[model samples]
Target: MLAQLRQQAILERVRRTGGVRVAELVRDLGVSDMTIRRDLEALADRGLVEKVHGGATIVGAGSTEEPGFTAKSARQQAEKEAIARHAARLVRPGSSVALSAGTTTWTFAHHLADVPELTVITNSLKVADVFHRAGRPDQTVVLVGGVRTPSDALVGPVAVAAIRSMNVDMLILGVHGMSVKAGFTTPNLLEAETDRELVGAAQRLVVLADHTKWGTIGISTIARLEQADVVVSDTGLSGEARAALSEHVGELVLADPGADEREAPAP
Candidate 1:
């Protein structure tokens, strides 16, 4: 109970301040240095914070420092899984789907393991690996060639060129942040351009983002909210958020973390 409370407090402080120092945490939480270190380590393990030399920072804080894959994998486990499950349902067998690279998108790849007769085009080494290792023989995987980003994504001209050449049935995209004004934004410029091209290549675009993405703005805008065909999020979203999203997106699908069913707004 004490650990959970401390964890929650750390999360709140991180959200408020964008980052926190070990000494500051010890002073503010009134805990021992060892205890504070443990807290930070646990948070880092969960992908909530990036452990620095003396402190920790938020994963996507306006900086070039990228969180390690292990750390990212730990953060938002439940939410990503739920989003992936919801995304998998949108894909039909024998259809070509383009998946953008991100931890959340990687989760979507896992759920596609059983999807028979599907063709996937992606720029993620992790996504390709998932399909190569377990994907059925009937399924075809096309991995775009490009320089890999810190988040294990391939972007830039090579990736953009590949996307432009092919037409995909659906695109499952992930973003660093989304706002009514800012649209879909990311921290990396090259990634933003590649995402824009991906959106253009697909007949339908579905954005997979969690509630935490609300209100935050990144450096570059890929597309507006209205540009997305569908948006899938968790039930933890606020009423205002639901209404705000409904105004832009054609369909809003809210998935319950506890169940497989989804609450979708009427067409």
Candidate 2:
């Protein structure tokens, strides 16, 4: 495809989906990675799209717009995979962890099942299902029941009530959008409350978000950046975002999905 045609296609995809990954475009267009990157850069320069590390998104997606699980799952595949791998390292065996509903948390649940003697308490039906499928006696998975959101999360009073009584070692939260000013947020009001409760119930907060989440702001704030113990993101996170998040969150680690799998946390 010609540069103009390819760029137009890129913009149209971003317009329809709110985001487009270069890898996906490369496969579909049968072009080089550098060519796709160049096309995204040109579009970004024209104020038509927002350029991110691995992809581009519809400009100004921060304003209370939220995509469902599948939409999110498709946006940043490699980044989520890398972040999940690193987040999994934080879990020591025999620890109780709380996972919030989001695509990244669902990915983390897959990795958590491999750990020995872990009890996972989560508001995500998808996360619970991972353990259910694994059928591991040593790993106990708690599925918090509540109102189901489009993102496949169980939120609201029922989830909050359950979270209030239990304390966990960590809360691995996936957010709709995050920023220095907005902190961690969700577009759904009830989900925000449940996420806050999950944050409060844990000894530590580790947010698992991809780079695209940086500038987006949801309707409700769950917690401030300083409240987090750690933030695990992919290397695709922009340098400026990395600097800002590192400053506020204290410990910001980047995950390279291409890296060989590191040893899991010691039991």
Per-residue lDDT of 223 in model 1: 95
Candidates in order, TM-scores: namely 0.77, 0.76
How many clashes does each candidate structure show, in the order listed?
A: 1, 0
Tens digits of per-residue lDDT, candidate 1, 1-267, equal 398899889888776656667777788788899998899899999999877656776775562344434335555667778888998899999999999888789999998989889999998888889999994899999999888886788899999898889999999998888889999888788888998998999999999988777776878898999999999888878899899999999898887666643455556
Tens digit per residue, CA lDDT, model 2, 101-198: 98899998899877999989999988888889999989888898899987789988999999999999999999877899999989999999999999
- The C-alpha stretches of model 1 lying farther than 4 A from their native spots are 1-60, 63-66, 260-267
Model 2 regions more than 4 Å off? 1-62, 260-267
